[model samples]
Target chain A: MKKTINIPLGSQHIALLEPVRFSFTCENETIVGVEADVGYVHRGVELACTTTFKFKQVGYVVARVCGLCAIIHSTCYTLAAEELMGQEVPRRASYLRLIANELDRIHSHMLCLAHTAENAGFEALFMRTMKDRELVMEAQEAMTGNRVQFDYVSIGGVNRDITTDIEALIRQRLGLLKEKVGEIKELFENNWSLSLKYKGVGIITAENAYRNSALGPLARASGIDFDVRNESAYLPYGELGFASVTMSEGDIHARNMVRLLEVFESIRLIESALDGLPEGEIAAKVRGTPEGESYMRVEAPRGECFYYLKASKGQYLDRVRIKTPTFGSVPAMIEALKGANYADAPAIIASFDPCLSCTAR
Target chain B: MFKALLNALKNLFSAPATLNYPFVSSPKHQGARGLILFDEPKCVWCLKCEEVCPPGAIRFTQDRESYAYTYHYNPYLCIYCAECVRACPDKAQALSQCSELSRPTSDPFMNDAWFALEKEAEDSKEAVKELKKAKKTEETPQP
Candidate 1:
C-alpha cells in the first residue's frame, strides 16, 4: 500500500478564482508536502511588451496582466518609465495615483475576504461582502472612468482630473463603505463559526514568514511589519500618512483581521488624499522616449509589485521584467500547508489572496 | 444564531438590492472611458492617433495616387483606453471618447474583415513611401 495519497487542488477547482494548481501529499488527513504551479494563466505579456508595444504604450499592455490590480501594474510601469526619461510628475498627479491605488486595494481585500468566507462554507457572508464591495466599485468607476481596468495612470501623470462632482461621489460612497466595513469587521472578529474555520489554521510563524519571504497581508499577519508602501517612495504613500496593519497570530483569522483593518486604513488614506489633492494640471507633457534602465515597486493589494525597465532611448523597450507578489508568497504558502488539515486547504489558499494571473504573467 | 434569524427575516421583507437588468439599464457614470469618436474634416491627417493606439485599433490607409488618407476604426478591437483622444493634436480636436460601450456584433466575419484591413493599411503605407521616393528621384538630377 502507498504510504501517502496525493490530492490536487486547482488548475480547475471550485475553490479557485484564477488558474493555479497545487499538489498535496497527504499522510492520512494532514498535508505533509505541498507543491504549487502558478503558471497556468501565463499570457506572454513580457514578450509582447518588448517586441510589440512602444514604451509609451507598454503601460496599457502590462495593466492587462491582472484584472484586480490593473492600476498598480500600470502605475508601477509608468513610474519606472518616467524615471528612465527623467520626467517630473506634478504633485497632484501622484496624489490621484495614490487615491486610485488605495481604492484598488480596498476592493481587492474585500474580494479576498468574500472568497475566504465562501470557502469556509459561510455562503451568506460571502454574498454580503460582495454586496458591500459594489459601493467602492461604483466610486472607482466614477473616479477613473472604468469599473475594472482603470487606465488612469499615464507616462508623466494621470489621464483624468478630479472634478468636484467626482470628488463628492467618491466621498459619499467611501463613507457608506466605512460604515458597512465596520459591521463586517465585527462579524469577522466575533462570529463563533467563522473562528472555527479561520482561527489557528494554516499558521505561518513570524520567523517562517521572514525565511520564506512572504509579503503583503500574509507576512503582515505573521507580524512581519513589512509593507512595500511604507518601505518605498514609488508612490506618495509616505506623505499620505500610510500605516500598515499587522497581527501576531499568523493564521487565517489573523490574515483576515489584517486585511479588514487595512481596508479602514486605505479608506482613510483616500479621503485624506482627496482633501489634499493639489491644484495643477492632471497630466504633464510627455516629450521623450525612456532611456537606460530603471526599476520600480508599488504596493499592490496583494503585495509588492516590482517592474524592471531597460530602454535604450528607443520606441520599444529592450526588456520589461515583472515580479508580482503571489510569486514571492508561494514558498510561504507551501510552508504553511505542510502540517495543515486537508479540509482546510481551500480556506487557507483563499486567505493568501493569490493572484496567479499576476504571478504567471 | 438568534441574531442571524432576525436579520434574515428582516432582510426577506426588504426590497431587492440588484437592479432589474432587462428593464432597467445600468449606465456608466459621466466621463466613463468608452468608444472613440473620430471626425473626418477636423483631422489634419497627422496619423498621430494611429501611432499611439496600443492595440492598433485605429489605422489609416493612404491613397497611393492622390496621397489622401482614410481613417479606419474597429470598435471591437478597441480597448477604450482613450489614448487616441489624448494623442490627437489640440488644434485638430478630431478625436474624442464617448461613454457608450462597444456592442457585440452579429457578423461572423467582423474580425476577419478587420484583419484584412490591418494588412491593407500596412501595405498602403509601404506603397506611399515607394511613390514618394520615386517622385523625389524624378525631380533630382541623376549623378
Candidate 2:
C-alpha cells in the first residue's frame, strides 16, 4: 500500500494561467516530492534587451516582461537608467509613479485572489472578484492611457501627468473597489468551504521561507518582514507612508489574507500620494546617454523584481539581467507543495500565484 | 450559511455581470490603447517611430526622386505600448481603443497596408502643391 505514483500538473492546465510544469510524486493521496519546470514562456527577454532595444526604449521593452506587473518593470528599469545618467525625477512624477505602482499592485492582487477562488471551485467568487477588478483597470487606463502595459514610466520621469478629471475618476473607483474588497475579505475569512480548502494547507514555516528566500505576500504570510518598497529609495514610497502587511500563519488562507490586507494599505498609499501630488513638469530633459552600470529592485505584486543593467557610453546596453521574484520563490513553492495532499495541489499552487512569464522572462 | 443563502438570493435579482459581447458591445475606456493611427501629412519622415518600435513593427522606405516616404505597419508584431506615438515629434502616430481586432494572418499584403496609405497621402499632397503653384503663376500677371 506504500507505492508511489508520479503525477504531472502542467505545461498547460485549466488551473494555470501560464505554462509551468510541476511533477509531483505522491504516496496514495499525499504528495511526497515536487519538481518544477519554468522555462516554457521564456522569449529571450535578456538577449533582446541588449541587442534589439536602445536605452531610451528599454523601459517599454521591459514592460513586456510580465503583463500583470508591466508598470513595475518599466519603473524599475527607468529607475536604474536614471541612476546611471544621474537624472533627478520631478516630485510630481515621483508621486505619480507611486500611484501607478500601487494601482498595479491592487489589480494584480485581485487577479491572484480571483484565480485562487476559481481553482478552489468557487466559480461565483471568481466572477465577483473579476468584476470588482475592472474598477482598478478603469482607473489605470484613465491614468496611464492603457489598461495593461501602460509604458507610463520613462527614464527621467513619467510619460503622463494626472489631471483633476483623472484624479476624481481614480478616487471614485478606489472608493467602490474598497467596498467590494471588504465583501471579498469577508467571504475569504468566514466562508466555511473556503476555510476547509485553505486553512492550514500547504504551509511554509518562517524558517523555510527565509531558507528558500521567499518574498512578497508569500514571505510576509510567514511573518518575514521584508518589502523592497520599504527598503528601496527608488520611489516616494517612504513619503507616502508605505507599510508592508504581514501575517504569522503561512497557509493558503494566510497568503490570501496578506493580499487582502495589503490591498487596503495600497489604497491608503495611493490616496496619500494623490493628496500630496506636487505641481511640476512630468518629465525632465535628457541630454546624455546612460553610461555606467547600475542595478535596481522593485516590489512586484508577487515579490521582488530586480533589474541589472550594464552600459558603456552607448545607445545599446552591454548586458541586461532581470531576476524576477518567482525565480527565487520556486524552491519555496516546491517545499510547500511537498507533504501536501495531491487533491489540494492546484489550490496551493494558485495561492502562490506563480507568474511564469516573469519567472522565465 | 445564512450569508451564503442571502448572497444567493441577492444574486437572483441582480443583472448578469458578464457582458453580452457583439450585442451589448465590449467596454473600453477612453484612453485605452487599441489601434495604431497614422497622419501621413503630419509625419516629417524622421523614421523615429521605426527606430523606437520595440518589436520592429514599422518599416519605412523613401523614394529619392519624389522625396516622399512609404511606411509599413504590421499589427501582429506591435506591442501597442504607443512608444512611437510618444516619440512622434508632429504627433502623427496615435492609438485608439475602440478599433476591431484583426484576424491573425501570415499574408504579406495584409501587413503592408500602411504603405498604400502613405502613397495615397503623398500623391494627394503633390496634387495640392501643383495646384498652389499654378494659382501663384496666374496671379503674377504673366511675369
Candidate 3:
C-alpha cells in the first residue's frame, strides 16, 4: 500500500546544534523518502566579505562562519589570497598552521563523539569525553594563544611562532592524551548496548557514497579511502606519513570507528610535525596585484571545504565563494536515511556530524 | 541475548571512566591562553597594539597634555591572538591574564574607557625640577 507519512524533524532538536528541517516520508516505521531544508541561520558571509570587508579583514569574518572549523576557514582563505598574490609561505609557518588545523580536527571530532554519546543516553561517557576533549583545547590555547578562532594564520603565513617550550608542551600533552583515548575507546568497545545501537544502522553503500561525492570520514567509512590530505597534500601533511582510515560496513558504527581511529592519526601527525619542524620566519611580506581567480581546498572536520576567491587591484575582494562539506554530505545523508526506522533518523543525522553554520555561510 | 545481557552487566562493575567536571577542574598547562588584562598606568600613546590587532578589538586615543595613551579592549571581536601584547614597544604591560571573556550578545565596539599611563619615578622628579627652574628663571627677570 502507498501511503504518505510526514515526519518533520525541525529547525530545533536535541540532535542538532544549528537549525535544519528534514521531512521524511515513511511507510509504517521505515522512512521511504527524505527532504532537507536549511538556511535557517544564513548571515550571508560571502556577500558581507565582498561588499564591506577588505581582504585582510575577511579572515575574521570567514572564521565566524563556523566556530567549529574556524581555523580551517581562515587558513584556506589566507592560502587563497597567497595564491592570488603568488606568494610562498615560510615553511615553519606552514607547519604551525598544520598543527592548529590538526588540533581543531581533534577537538571537533571529540565533540561529535560526545554528542553521539549524549544522544544515545550515555551521559557519563558524554561528560567524560568532553572533559578529555578540553585537553586538546588547552593544547591549542598553549600554541596559538586562543582556544577557538586562533587568528594565527595570515595572508603571507602564520602570525605567530611556536617556541621550544610550546613544542615540548604539545608533545607531553599528546603522550597523556594517547593513554586517555585508549581508556575511552576501551569503555566504548566494551559497551554492548552502544554497539547494538550504532552497528548496522544508517547503512550507506560504497557505490552511493562515491556517486553523491561524500568526503571526509563519511566517505572513508564506506571504504572509499579518499582524503584531501593524501590527494591534495597541502601544507606539512605531505611530509607526515599517515593512512586514511576506512571500514566497509558504512554503518553508523563504522563511521564512529573511523573518527575514533583518525584521532590517533591526527595525534601522530602532530607529533611528527613537532619533531622535524624547520626553522624559518613565521610570515613573509606580501605585496602585489591579485588579478585572477583561484580555488583552494582543505579537509575540514565534516569533510572537504573548497574556497573560490577572485581579487582585483583594489584592496576589497572582488568575489568570494565557499563550498562547505555540509552541502556535499546532505544528499548522501538523505540517501542513507531512506529505509531506516523513523526512530533511527536522529542517529543517522548525527552520524554525519552536520555543521549547519558552515552550510548556511 | 541473555548471555549478552550478562556480559553488559559484568561491565557495569568496572570503575567509571568519566571525569567529574563540576567538582574537578580540567588540567591546566603552562602556556594555556587564559584571559587578557590591561595595566592602566604604563601606557604610551603609540597605538601600535591597535595597528597590529587582526580583529580591531583594541582602540586607543592620545592625551596631548599628559603625552600618554588611553586604551580599550573589546572582548567581543578579540580573538585572543595576543598580537597587541607582542607589538607594544613600551612593554605597556597593559595585557593581563583573563579567561571568562565570551559572553552572550557581545558587541564589538563596547570597549571604550581610559587607562592612565604610569610615570617613572625619575621622570616625575625631573618634571618637578624643570617646573621649579622655570619659576625661578621667571622670577629672576629676563633682559
Candidate 4:
C-alpha cells in the first residue's frame, strides 16, 4: 500500500537540541524529501522589543531570545542603539565585550559539539566535553556576574568592568580548555566509530550550501568561507587577529571539526583581548535617545545574529527586526536532509546545531 | 582503546567533576550577582530603583493618610541584573546587590500579592495626586 514512508524527527525528540519538527519522506531507509517546522517556540521577542519595553530595557529583553547566545543578542542590539544615539563606547568596554563574546562562543560551540557527540551515540565523549565546558562557564560567571543570561552589555558601554583577578581566572580556564579541546579534537578525528557516523554521512556540496544560503559553521563546513566575525567590526575582533575556521568536507564530521577548531580560535581571541585590555570608565553617561534607523551584526556562536533597529527619537522603538542564524540555515538543513540515510538523521541534524527558540523568536 | 582504558582507570581514582548539591555547597565567586538589598533608613524615597528595575521586582506603595512610602520587593521576579543599583544615586546608595541569593519564597501568594501591590502602588499615587490638586484648588479659591 504505502510506497514512501514518512518519519517525523521532532518538536520533541531524544536527539534534538530544541523544539523543532522535521518530517522526512524516506524510500527504504534513504531520505527523499524533508519538511521542517521551526515556528513552534515563537515568543514574539521582536514585537516585545518594540511595543512592550523601552529602548533602554530592550537590551535585557532581547538577551532572553536564546539562552546560549544571550550576550551576543544584547551586544548586537546595544551596538545598533549606540550607533543611533551616537554613543562612543569606551575602549576597555569594547575589549571586555569582546572577551565575554568569545567566551560565549567557546562555551556555545562546546555545547553544540557535546550534543553532536551525544546524538551520534557517544555519551562518554558528550559527558567529558560538558565537564570541560564548565571551565568557561565558571570563567563567564566570575567575569559577567551571571551564568546564562548575562546582562553585561548596556547601551553606552558594558555594565561591569573586568578585574585583574577575573583576568587571571579566564586565562587559567582557557589554558585548561585548550588542552582538553586538543584531546577532544583527536578523538573526533581518529576514532573509527565517530568517523562511521560523521565523516561522510550528511554531505552538503559547496554549491548547495551557497545556493541554499547556509550560515555559520554549516556554510563554512561546506567551504563557503563566510563568517560574520571576519566580515564585520562590531567588536574588536580585527585587533585581536580573529580568523574564521572553514572546512571542505561539508559533512557531519566537517561541521564538528569546524566547531572544534573555532573553539581553539575563540580561546586565543579571549586570551589576546584580556592581555591587551585597556583601562577606562566601564560605562559612559548616556545622554540622548536613539533617533535614527540602524542595523548591527554580531557573530553569535551559531552564526550571524543581525538586528535591524528603527527608533524615532522616543523611549519605545518604532520597530525591531531580528534575523537569527538558525532561521537562515533551515533551508540548507532541509537540503542536507534530502539525501541522508534515515539512520544518520539525528547525527546530521545535531551537526547543524539548530536553535529553534532563537529561530522562532 | 588503550587510551580509553587508561582514561577509565584515571577517572576511577579522581574526584567527581560535579559538586554534590545540598551536601557540599556550590562555589560562589566574588562579584556574583545576587539579591537586591534595600536600606529603609538610608532610602530617600526617590523611587529610582522602582523606576529602573526591568522586571518590576521592586515597588513602593504610598499610604494616603500619612503619605509615607512602603517598599515591596519580590526576589523571584528579579532578574538580578543590578540595573536598579546602577540607577540609584551615588549619595543614596540605598540599593546594593548581595553576592548570593538563595531561593526565596516560591508560594503563589507572593506572586499574586505582587500584582495587588503593583495596582495599589499606582492607585495610591493617583489618589495622592488628586488630593494635592484638590488642595491647590482650595488654596486658590474661586478664581
2 or 4, greater by lDDT: 4
lDDT of 1 by residue, B40-133 (tens): 8999988999999999999898898998999988887788899999888999999998777656344433788888988999999999999999
Which lDDT tens digits does candidate 3 get at residues A218-304? Answer: 999999988888888668687887678888999988888888888999999999988888998988877885669999999998889
The candidate 2 chain A region of ten consecutive residues with least summed lDDT is A154-163
Candidate 3 runs further than 4 Å off: B1-55, B59-76, B83-143
TM-score of chain B of 3: 0.52
Q: What is the lDDT of residue B75 in candidate 4?
A: 86
Candidates ranked by DockQ: 1, 4, 2, 3
Query: RMSD of candidate 1 to the true fold?
Result: 1.4
Better of 1 and 3 by lDDT: 1
Give TM-scores for every candidate, taking all chains together and pairing residue i with residue i. 0.98, 0.89, 0.81, 0.98
Residue-level lDDT tens digits of model 4 in A277-352: 8877888999889998999998888888999999899899999999999999998999998888999998899899
Residue A59 lDDT, candidate 4, scale 0-100: 93
Best by lDDT: 1
lDDT, candidate 2, A67-163, per-residue tens: 9999999999998988998988888888899899999999999999999999999998998899999999989989987788788888778877788
- lDDT score for candidate 2 against the true structure: 0.87
Off by over 4 Å in 1: B1-3, B104-109
Task: Give DockQ for candidates 1 onward, in order.
Answer: 0.74, 0.46, 0.24, 0.70
Q: Listing every candidate in turn, what is its Cα RMSD in Å to the true structure after a full C-alpha superposition? A: 1.4, 6.6, 7.8, 1.3
Score candidate 4 by DockQ.
0.70
Candidate 4 residue pairs that clash: A10-A21
lDDT of model 3 at residue A125? 70
